[model samples]
Target chain A: MLHIVNKSPLERPSLDACLRIAGPGTVLLIEDAVYAAARGSAAAPRLAEAMQRLKVCVLLPDAEARAIADRLIDGVTTVDYAGFVDLVAGHPNCQSWL
Target chain B: MTEGIAKKFMFVNRSAPYGTVYALESLEVVLISAAFDQDVSLVFVDDGVWQLKKGQQTKGIETKNFSPTYRALEGYDVEKLYVERESLEARGLDEGDLLVDVTVLSSGELGRLMDEQDVVLSF
Candidate 1:
């Protein structure tokens, strides 16, 4: 399963849901969703823990126009748009929580 | 309308066009998807219906009124525009006030459409 998140990183419902359901899958961040992996974001620490436990692969663009992408915890891989699409196509179940 | 082709994509617009970047960004994505020959459908609910209102004046806000862009969508082959009937009534707007032709659907019908899509993108 691949979950695509495009909402602000601080949002709780989507992140909580993702952690509960995502097991050994992938997480692709696009648009504002990339904020979760930023270095100092409040959401990063919790996500990092979930990422480790689930063995989830995280992908986010290096930059966005309005906000700088930072705070990528260990083990989360950054990827580009093509890689994002590939991850989506590869998954049997894809959910976009925007 | 090619029969049996699974090219349908649904876009759910949830915010007003000018208040934030979401609306404009969604429009660009829609155009891109349509360019790929996908069957595109849009659902405007909540404050998103404000994007379709006629006679929008954005001069005081120092930004261009993007209300006109809805009309240009037809040129790009994105013609399946839907508006929640309840949203229009709540906003005191009717089909006459929208600049584009739209199919007004009840909430139940909208849910059915969402289930029928091959792809669902919400913004």
Candidate 2:
């Protein structure tokens, strides 16, 4: 399954919920959720731990839009919308954590 | 409708309108999605139920009232709208209080329906 989270971790529990249920699947951060991928944000440590188990990525456009492209944590891959479409197609199902 | 494949797409609305841009932006995606001719459905749960409440007054907020645009969804061939029964009841809302007609389903049934979708987008 592909877990897509679009809510800010600072404002909502969607990222926490997604991390709890995401097994070996991919977690793609989009919209405001991209903030969680930043280097010194509140979600960085948890995201680092999650990266050890599964692929953790952030939408490149979203990160760039927020001017955090240079601040993304190490090992978090960045993907474009076409890559997002590919991830969706490759996964059996997708759960959007709002 | 297109003569090719159509994937099942479900847009889950879980927030109230106007408070945030999610509800409005989600509606924008739904409207644009009609061009793809996909099998699209919408599910309203949690505060999302408030989006359908009738006589929404945005004058106090100075925002354009977009709730009425929901009634135009059918003309775009996007007609599958579901509201969670438990959510409505929990919020002290009834079917009669909603602005649009919808098929109300139990949370369990809605979960099953969600599992059947190929794509699920939440807002």
Candidate 3:
């Protein structure tokens, strides 16, 4: 199940909701939601845990105006806009969380 | 008029007014669509309700108060503004406290409205 998160860090919900269900999926971060990739955010620990436990492939646009690339913790892969479109085109089960 | 005659494009605003770019971006899309004379409606849910709150002080944030822009929306013939009742109650706000007149709808009603929309975008 692919998860597209477009919400800011403070407004995000518990990662446990997505983590509890184990599956090989991708996570795309866009808009203010890119903050989820930022270091030291409350969402980081759980996201990291999910990546380690589940094969969660996290993707955030590198050229997106938001300067969150340098802030993302390790394990989260950064991609470009084309990569994002390709990722979505490849995945079928997408759940957008805003 | 026939019920549900128009292909409603519902813009769901979910962010606060300042400290984020989503609010302004969403408004621009709405105005552009209005220029094309498309059928559009707006719904403010979650922290998006703050955009309609009265007495906003953007000086400390060094941002302009775009609240007045919402008031001008009526002149553009885009007047279907719906605010979530639960969100308003949660934030301790009511229609009287908003910058513009809005019909407050429950979450369920809001969901139904969403289902009726041919296109939905969240900001």
Candidate 4:
């Protein structure tokens, strides 16, 4: 399954909830959720652990918008909207952890 | 709703009480769900922890102080409240600083509780 989350972990717990509730799957972080991928952020350590079980990806444009594109946690893949579509197509189903 | 069987409904509050409308909106729904006699559970995480802090003075911000409403939740029979330990500690807050009683649990523990719920609402 593909799990999508779009809230900042600093201001909200959507990312944390998603990481906990979701099984092994693709986690696509968009909007403010991109902040969780930034290195040195409090949420980064948890996000890094989540990578061991899931293929974590962040929307590049979103990260760039936040200016954290350069400091993403080591293993998180950067994707554009095109990559986003392919992920949805690849997964049997998805949950928008909105 | 269903005649007699009460479904477990968890309301996951993730927003602060002020600066946005989400926190207040979430509380209003919790009240209605109680009226329907559903089993209600409230979980606070991240900035949502601020909602339960003691002695909030919203007068300076001109926003209606609503943190006290959480204290009133028990009168509505909404007793099950949980706060994420990590979120609380990260914010430099503890149970004693809160206005009401709550069980602090880890994310893993909360996830198990969420899995048992029939419905989960997030704000």
Q: Whose lDDT is greatest here?
A: 2
Candidate 3, lDDT over the whole model: 0.72
Error of 2 at B44 (Å): 0.4
Superposition TM-score, candidate 4 onto the true structure: 0.69
Docking class of 4: incorrect
TM-score winner, 2 or 4: 4
Model 4 over residues A9-85: C-alpha lDDT tens digits? 99866887789756667899999999999999999999999999889999999999999999998999999999999
lDDT score, candidate 4: 0.87
lDDT tens digits by residue: candidate 3, A1-98: 45566666576642333343225567676677667667898877877877864444445553246766666788877766787777767764354546
In model 4, pairs of residues that clash are none
Score every model by TM-score. 0.56, 0.62, 0.58, 0.69
Question: Of the candidates numbered 2 and 3, which has the greater DockQ value?
Answer: 2
Tens-digit per-residue lDDT, B24-122, candidate 1: 888889888877888899988757788888888989999877778889999998999999887788789999999999999876577556656677787
- Candidate 1 stretches with Cα past 4 Å from truth are A1-98, B1-6
Q: i-RMS, every candidate?
A: 7.6, 4.9, 8.1, 4.7
TM-score of chain A of 4: 0.97
How well does candidate 2 match the true structure in TM-score terms? 0.62
Q: Which is the winner by TM-score between candidate 1 and candidate 4?
A: 4
> What does candidate 4's lDDT look like per residue over B22-114, in tens digits?
999999999999999999999987788998989899888998887888989999999999998888998999999999999999877876676
Which CAPRI level is candidate 1? incorrect
Q: After superposing candidate 4 on the true structure, give the runs of residues whose Cα lies further than 4 Å from its correct spot.
A: A1-3, A8-17, A20-48, A54-98
